[model samples]
Target: MDNPTAGIDRAAPVVARHELTIRAPATAVWGLLTDVPAWPSWQPDIVSARARTPLTPGATFHWRTAALDIASTVYAMEAPRLILWGGPAQGIVAVHQWTLTSSGPAATLVTTEESWDGAPVRADAANIRQALDDSLAQWLGHLKTAAEKPR
Candidate 1:
């Protein structure tokens, strides 16, 4: 799944935010988010992924897509609440969060927020912004479909 062809946006620092609501419980979403190995099934952008070590602070993981190669290290992991991490320098530093709230008797509101802080592939802020915006949108769409699926 190594995306040797994946374009890297190395312009100025860019920030992207993507959010989605899931009908599933926070716990369900948490399970999927924390389990790095399961990402390929739902996250279409990531063709394959695996953690080089367990998912703990400082543990590294490698993920691949048709257009990108992502290497990340877990910064924080608090089940049913938050999971944050970033990638190697020149790579996207991402904070992936899952917030679950009780809606009523048999339902939960699962909200996911993904943000990235990094340099753009070029100097044009507009172009970088466009890429970030598009990337986040695609990511959120993939996450929404995956998180909403039956476990």
Candidate 2:
């Protein structure tokens, strides 16, 4: 859309971004980041997740995070680099994307962005924006923790 996101709604009511540098390679970070079904093990909010083997565009995945059941399609993806996915849930149409870039010999700069629209978001833009920001911030923190841990 208008923002840098791959497939987010161009005119979403709220958009949020959060990023951090992880002390690990992008490949290592990507491996932990993209495996949908394995999310619950590392992501505390992700109660459950399941997706087709080898994520690809148009492949839909179902996941529960923050007690919200979400089914998002793989709108776009690039191996070990970026993924964009989202769909309607609980009266909110949300789009989320993750980007990974190598920052140094063994470091990765991770960026996550998301957009939310629909009646609920439109009605409570400020609160929704903060929620989205907080959610992304938490997700990024988890990713960094998981990715940086010694494996």
Candidate 3:
């Protein structure tokens, strides 16, 4: 498969990557990941989220988080596997990607990667990196909890 974040420089100073294993099927994880409006329920940092149009390539979504409000466009989407989206917010340009792999009949390996650039990100790389790391970790934990619960 093509690299979802191909254009973004991985060596950039303000980049954050996180991965976690979820004991659930990829379909379940993918459903939760793509449901934009439901994000705030599991993602503590997200204040609100609404898709401006259907979630497909070039479609946009507005997201409000504790740090900033961003208008993100879906750059890539591969059902039950990968989704990538990002945009500029508060002087920072960001690209976020989520990849899911089914490890077994009822297990999955989930990874979330994000890259940030622009003036604000470069000005405070350390804090931005830490914040992104923490946020990603929290997101993964929330996903694990949500996915692990019995339906």
Candidate 4:
């Protein structure tokens, strides 16, 4: 079980990073993130989301994405802070973490981190990683726009 994320620096991993500083508070950003119905309005990749349990540490969720028709459980959740989860791809599991922090003056820094576990059977691990990375970038950009929009 080698570290899939090893040899990659914070500046950039083998997979790309999608980051944005939202001009809204963490709470506001979290609201947009956790809102199931609104996700499809902004996040083109996420087809749907439903809470299997209240947003507790061990609470669960069903996340469906258009990219892979994948549904993953919510492994971790903390409002105005973090959401972590993963889904299986050809027996290889992929994990992702979304973290939000207050930057200042009603601003929040949002970061998405992703990693894969197990060898990829497709032998296109790099391409797959890049696709995931690009998707995250699109997602984050959409979030930034949505968060900044007047409500």
Q: What would the TM-scores of all predictions be?
A: 0.71, 0.92, 0.92, 0.78
Model 3 collision count: 0
For model 4, what is the error of residue 151's alpha carbon versus the real structure, in angstroms, after optimal superposition? 1.2
> Tens digits of per-residue lDDT for model 2 on 1-151?
4432356675788999888999999998889877889999989989999986667888888999877999888887898899888888999988888899999879999999889988999999999899889989999999889988887
Residue-wise C-alpha lDDT for candidate 1, range 1-151, written one tens digit per residue? 1221122222325555555566666776667777888888888778899986668776888888646787876666666666666554354455544455655533455544444444543355567667767866776677657767775
Q: What lDDT score belongs to each candidate, Candidate 1 first?
A: 0.61, 0.86, 0.86, 0.70
- The digit string of per-residue lDDT tens for model 3 on 1-151 reads 1343463448667777889999999999998888999999887778999986679988999989876889998888889898889888888888888999999989999999888888888899999899989988999999999889899
Locate the minimum summed-lDDT window of 10 residues in model 1. 1-10
The C-alpha stretches of model 3 lying farther than 4 A from their native spots are 1-8
TM-score of 2: 0.92
- Per residue, candidate 4 scores C-alpha lDDT tens digits across 1-151 of 2332232223222345677899998998889877765688888778876775555544446666754555555666777798776556556566667899899968999998776545562466677777777888888899999999997
In model 3, state the lDDT of residue 93.
80
Worst 10 residues of 4 by lDDT: 4-13
Choose 2 or 4, whichever is better by TM-score. Answer: 2
Can you give the lDDT of residue 69 in candidate 1? 80
How many residue-pair clashes does candidate 2 contain?
A: 0
Q: Residue 15 lDDT in model 2?
A: 90
Model 2 score (lDDT): 0.86
